[model samples]
Target: MLYAILAYHVEEEVASWTPEEDATVMRDLNKVHGRLNELGRLGPAARLGATEGACVLRGPRKGVVTDGPFTESKEQLLGFYILDCADRDAAISAARDLRQVNPSAMYEIRPVKLYLPGVPFPRTEDGVDA
Candidate 1:
């Protein structure tokens, strides 16, 4: 199964880190990433730009666009990783490893629902998995 691990951290806290501290954190995280890559579990990953440059688009009919990272919380989405895991437990284990490296942030693991070409849409009736 494919899982998306979303990394969230306080923008101020991350931006305030010293250069050495940032490098050390990244080094530790990269160690974990290297292992995952060797195991063929790592997929697409990226570090997002600062939230200040972000824009939100809403209202499909009106196509209204607004500038902001998100309206809900202070913590900004820092990064994400697409991991191929055997199951939910494996994905959680992978997230745990990341949490160890960066203890100040939160990671959200979600299964990816891929829309493949020529595939029938997943049934949404009767509270079934979709």
Candidate 2:
């Protein structure tokens, strides 16, 4: 089965990190990613931008567009990882590996019912995972 590992953290806390601190976390996470990739269990990963530049469309048809990441939770979703695992336990294990490096963050793992990955889009930059 395929699972989505959602990464969440307090925006202020993450935004407070130095460049080096952020890089360290990414490096360690990439190590786990490498192992999973080697096992052919990893899929497309993403790092979302801050809510400051985000918008939300609510209600009917061409709904009203609003600002910010408006979840009721304190922690905002900052990133995600897609993994192919044998079972729920395996999916949780993958999230655990991610949490080991970034202990302060939280993860929510959910099974993927369907994945429709479309044709590749043009690359703008050699940016981070997303």
Candidate 3:
């Protein structure tokens, strides 16, 4: 099964982090990612941009657009991870590992019911989409 781990955090708090602090968190996360890679469970992961640069579209034909995610809560979605897991427990375990290193952030684990079919994006030499 596939799981989507949605990461949510207070935007103001995260944005206030010093570069060193942010880098330290990333390094810690990379340790978790390394283990997932070894298990061949890591899929696509991303750190989303600020909500200020995001838009919400609604209404007919989804043409009604609004600024920001404007979530109903204090936390804004900061990123997500896709993992291939054996079961719900396995998915929860992965989210738990993530939470350990990011105590203040919230991780929402959900089973992926459908994955759109398509070829992956063309990658640059560095293995990232160009």
Candidate 4:
């Protein structure tokens, strides 16, 4: 199974971290990443650019574009990790390890659905599971 571990943190608080603090956090994350790599569980991972560079395109009827994520929340999404694990428990364990090093960071683990060409998606306009 594949799980997406989404990392979240306060933008202002993260930006205010000192050089030493930033280095320490990165060091700890690197250790976790290395362990995942050895286990062949780490897939795609990346730290997103600031929300200032983000934009949201509305549905076709409106077709309007808006700057920023425009979320009604304080914590902003920081990064994400895709882990190939045996099950949800394994994925949760991996996320827990990361949370220990960065207590302020919140991780959301979600199962990933793969989309294949020529295969119909599960949900349809009629609300039936295909």
* Counted clashes in each candidate structure: 0, 0, 0, 0
Please, what are the lDDT tens digits per residue for candidate 2 over residues 8-105?
99989988999899889989988999999999999888777887989888889889988976999999999898899999999999999999999999
Q: Write the per-residue lDDT of candidate 4 for residues 47-66, one digit (tens) a residue.
A: 76677878999878879898
lDDT tens digits, residue span 1-130, model 1 = 9999999999899999998998898899989999999999998776777788799888779788999766577788989999999999999999999999999999999999992336555534222545
Model 3 CA lDDT for position 112: 95
Q: Which residue pairs in candidate 2 collide?
A: none
Error of 1 at 1 (Å): 0.3
Supply the TM-score for candidate 3.
0.90
| Model 4 error, position 35 (Å) | 0.3
CA-lDDT, candidates in order: 0.87, 0.89, 0.89, 0.85
- Model 1 / residue 27 / CA error / Å: 0.5
Q: TM-scores of all models?
A: 0.85, 0.91, 0.90, 0.83
| Between candidates 2 and 3, the TM-score winner | 2
Look at candidate 1 and tell me the lDDT of residue 27.
91
Residue 10 displacement in candidate 2 (angstroms): 0.7
Per-residue error (Å), model 2, residue 113: 1.3
Location of the lowest summed lDDT over 10 successive residues in candidate 4: 120-129
Off by over 4 Å in 1: 115-130
Q: Which candidate number maximizes TM-score?
A: 2
Query: Per-residue alpha-carbon lDDT of model 3 for 28-109, expressed as tens digits?
Result: 9989999999999998887877778899887887488889687789999999999999999999999999999999999999
